[model samples]
Target: MAQRLQSISAVTVSGALVIVLLLTLTFGTLGAVAFRADSLSGLSTRDWAAVRFTVVQAFLSALLSVILAIPVARALARRQFWGRSVLVTLLGAPFILPVIVAVLGLLSVFGRNGLLSQALGFAGLEPVSIYGAHGVVLAHVFFNLPLATRLILQGWLAIPAERFRLAASLGFGARDILRHLEWPMLLAVVPGAFMVIFLICTTSFAVALALGGGPKATTIELAIYQAFRFDFNLSKAALLALAQFGLCAIAAVISLWVSIPAGQGAGLDRVVARRDGSRILDFTVLLLVTLFLITPLGVIAVKGLGSVLSLPASTYGAAGRSVCVALASALLTIALTLPLALLAQRVSKLIEGVGYLSIAASPLVIGTGLFILVYRWADPVVLALPITILVNAAMSLPFALRAIAPALAEVERDYGRLSDSLGLTGMARMRLVILPRLRRPLGFGAGLAAALSMGDLGVIALFADPDSATLPLAMYRLMTAYRMDDAHGAALLLLSLSLLLFWVFDRGGRVNADI
Candidate 1:
């Protein structure tokens, strides 16, 4: 009994540590940045403009992403043609894809000299420019559309076959089906999906940096970066960071109230046999979505092959560093997530909310805070990689927790008494009972964290000196230098590494996850 009590205490303490770490890294950094803000000047016109642009873009991005995703997700759920599984799997790529790489891909598709422009030029039309607020919204849609599709698709798949059958037998038309079956699922899932994507777009830094920076285009996070990096105006940066935090906090609060719906009333594990939609429409929706998402990737692969053989050693070194950081971040995420997951509900709800705040918090804001906190005692450059790892892990915490926490809870609920009666506690219980059951989510969450960290360009860009640059940062520098060939090659490499890291961990988890 004493040993079991000690084990439980240790788990509780570790969970508390995870909460403390999240608080210190998130709000603690925000607080440090706050102290440096110039209260007298407040936000300039440019600052307020950035703030408005940020909110508008995020709202538009989320709205459009969810709206477009409905048809695509419905098409996917209804159709099971060849390569369907592959198509579904690929939908997840944009989530882990490097932001710099994604920007490059977007440029290749929609830039003034890109395919769209070329087609227009062939028709003797003017070239369309992708360099402002519209471009930012477009890029965000590219990233979030797939996410929205997957979420809504999951909802569609959860609709029991009986529901569709019953509707069909009752002579339900498309309108009738939408009213009875689809509307409920969309109502339950779409709000959560929109809020999640909204929060994501609100904290965007790299997308705005690459495609939007004019008076009407700059986001709050981008403004913070400009103040810190170009102007060397720490006060302005701090103030902008505070604004960004307020925006995210508001969005997070809204998201909290908008809970992602749980699985609807379960059916006898059956595939939904959807029949209301037209085959032509379904096929067209699938094809358009595939082309939109895949063309950029195809361009990357083709363009990258020509220059990958000649990439500079510096790029390789940066890649190596990114890999190291990714691995470290993955391990740290797993460690922190496990304890936090194990101790869920036993810990304070406020602490859990703090852990999730990382989702809404800007990585740039966190990095800036860290620089401020560390500058008083240590070299920020020297701590760049470490801070990147810590921040990346924190940035990934909400997703990991969402994935792993429920699974851990389910395992503990099912086996708690069994383990206790068998005298299995501490390492023995974790290893023999909890872990085997948790392999799927653990591996998946770890993979997600690793891939995200590998492709992370946010915090590293803030703190990295030349020597400490990650591949995404180095790739961005190359792009800025007009080294298109090298940038494309580096992007391909980063994409491959991100995908591979995710695959390895995800596959490892599923290999024997039938427990």
Candidate 2:
């Protein structure tokens, strides 16, 4: 009974994803048909500038993320301190956190009147510009560094304990051991991490749109938004969207090629014979990562606290809307993602790859495709909120799959035959047998989906009207209007909401169902 329901849910989830992909592809095909022949002729100097800036920012963001990850990955690999697992889990949160929320936290710390500014004021030093290209880079690093750190750490963990034991037994020096074991792990993970960060930065609209001070800082995604929303230049927006797609598609292909297999055993506990390394190098690495990871957050918390009372009533309303949107998106994302995870588990590897496609594609790209589709059918697009929820759910699919797949696999491996023998088949099996056993993964996936949707500004930016703004979108408006106080308050609220949702969902997932 349970098996039968699982099968039905799995098929339904897979079908939903297929319908979405088809819609997106259909839009892309129409876009190509209408715009491809004329895109070159319509390209402007400003479009060229935006394209160049986008590429440069993404490349630099990727480079910095992977380079900075080296040490944190090393520390995480070598040390097993108190709260280490908690810290590792926290590192993964940024991947799910909305870009706008991170940007808010970043601004509260790094902005002109941010905490840093106040601290530097005492010494008569000016606060650095946290707008334009610089802000985008900082925000990108904040989000990507932790992700790269985790990925590289996974690679380090994959090295067999026997190899480390042999090295220790042979009295291998730190340099020799690193050259043989550490370097290999680093090399394998770095390129793929870089590519992921690069793809993310490439499609960034909120960060660029909010922080981009002028013509100088525009990214391609921002260009598309401006062309469509502000200027009402559909043809040009369509043209730029294609350009954005081409660049992202190439980057995605390269990223997928270099990506390491998403195996279940990678994050599991492993034993490695410990060896002494240069204390100086270890300390330096730890310090750099700590400063990079925690400082901005600290900055935001302090500054946000100072300005919290000054926030406007409208900001509060926006916060409420954001909460509703995040919650709805999270729920929708989990409901949709469950079946996709099951499909990935049950279907051929090739079809499983289709389930993983959301990672390689950005939210802006997906949203663009949807926009084209909607504009075809409706003049004003009445279903913006539902559409935003749907798109956010789809965007959250990769993270949802990553969180759920391993646990599902583990459950299947251990209980497949037992369940079958017990005559567990459809919905009965899922409710009675599978759900109880898979609570942890389900909760984790739910938390991730909620957190990611909370932090997201991509689809919301496209769909939100002035009266229908989510927190992230409202915060962007504040920043652009130079309403620093309001922006700070909203930023703090968004950050708290995202973290709280993540924590609740994560804890919820841990609840036992009496297996």
Candidate 3:
């Protein structure tokens, strides 16, 4: 019965995606027509500025985030200190924190009247503007640093202790030990993390738009948004979207082409010296990085306190809609992803690679494709919230796989032999066994989908109307109008929603023994 339900759910989900793809293709064509020939023409000086600014900002953001993460990650990996788990989990908060929320916090602390400004009050010294190119870089770093730290920490943990032990036994110093084992781990993880951060920065819309302060610092995503929203230049937006897609495609190709060592087959049980010569350095770096990463949230909390009650009823309405949409999307995402995951597991190892491909494709690109499809059928794609849910689910599939694949592997390893011995195969075995065993992964994936959908500004940014806005869209709207207080309030709400959903789903996964 469970297997039958799984099969049915999978079919339904695939069918929904097909419809979504068809709708998006239509929207893309219409957008193309709306943009016209001139929109697709060669770059203007403004375009050149945007292109240059985007590349530099993204490259720097990726580089800085990864570089700053190494020490923090090393500390987390090496020390079994108090509050380690809390710190590790806190790193994940920024992942779900709304861009507007982080921006607001950054502005409150780093802006002219910000806390730091008051601290460094000097005659003839002006306040630092958390706006323009600097602001964009700051926001990107804020968002990506924790993520990079976590990724690199995992890499650091993957190194066998035996390698470190061997080094210690050979009288190798800390520097020598790092050169041999740690450097290899860094080489393997840094590029991949950089690629992830770069891809995120490439499609950055809210951060650029809110912090950009003008035309000078616009990213391609911002340019596209401006063309569509401000100028009503659909052709321009369409052309820019095409360009953005091309660039992302090239980046994705390059990332895959670069050969990096995988984490697999690493020694797991090499005992290394816990006390190292670099302890002081590692502690200081960890302290600094943690403070930097957490400061934005702290500022938000301080600044946002007064504005919570000032939020209008509309904000609450939008929040409700966002919750509903996220919940629906989570369920639908799990429904669709489970079948695909199972199919991949059953067919070939290569099928598993699809998960990573989905990860590399920014949410905005997928949203664009679906938006293009939506326009073919009608005027307001925003009215079709059901379709939005499906798209959100598909978008979350890559992360879902990351969360579930390991558990799925373990389940297969433990149960495969038993199922075969019992003469159980195909639908019967899957229904009676596999689906039940997969409950934990399903819950984890569902929660992740819900949490991600809760905070998404991409698809809704393209399709949202006055009446159709979700929480993130509402928050962006507030920011665009320079309603910092309202935006801050909304950001807090969104952040809470994301974290709560994530916690709920994660707990479900844990109870079910998925991870």
Instruction: Supply the global lDDT for candidate 3.
Output: 0.73
Per-candidate count of clashing residue pairs (backbone under 3 Å)? 0, 16, 13
RMSD of 2: 3.5
lDDT string for model 3 (137-179, tens) is 9999999999999989888877777766767789887788688
**What's the TM-score of every candidate structure?**
0.95, 0.88, 0.88
- Provide the global lDDT of candidate 1 against the true structure: 0.89
Predicted structure with the largest TM-score when compared to the true one: 1
Give lDDT tens digits, candidate 2, residues 1-515. Answer: 65666666757666566646634543554454355336487989989999999999999988998888887887777765677787787787677666775676677668787678888998999877698887888788888889888878878788776677778888888788888777876777788989978988897777787677478899988887887778867777777777887788799899879986534233234576465586567667876766766776665666678777778777788788777877887787677666666665666434545556565555665666667666777743466677777777777766777777777778778887898888876676678767777787777777777777777777677767887777787888887788776676777778888889988987987876446
Top-scoring candidate (lDDT): 1
TM-score ranking from best to worst?
1, 2, 3
Which digits, one per residue and each the tens of the lDDT, describe model 1 over residues 1-515?
A: 99899888998889888878888988799999899888736899888999999999999999999999999998998787999999998898899988889899888889887889999999999989889999999999999999999999989988888778778899999889888788988998999899989999998888998899989999998898888888878888899998888889888888768865745576787765667879999999999999999999899999999998799999999999999999999989998888887777455445555568787678999988888888889988899999999999998988888898788778877998898899998889888998899999989999999999999889888888899999999999998898999999999999999999999999999988897
Kindly report which residue pairs in candidate 1 clash with one another: none
**Candidate 2, residue 99: how far the Cα is off, in Å:** 2.4
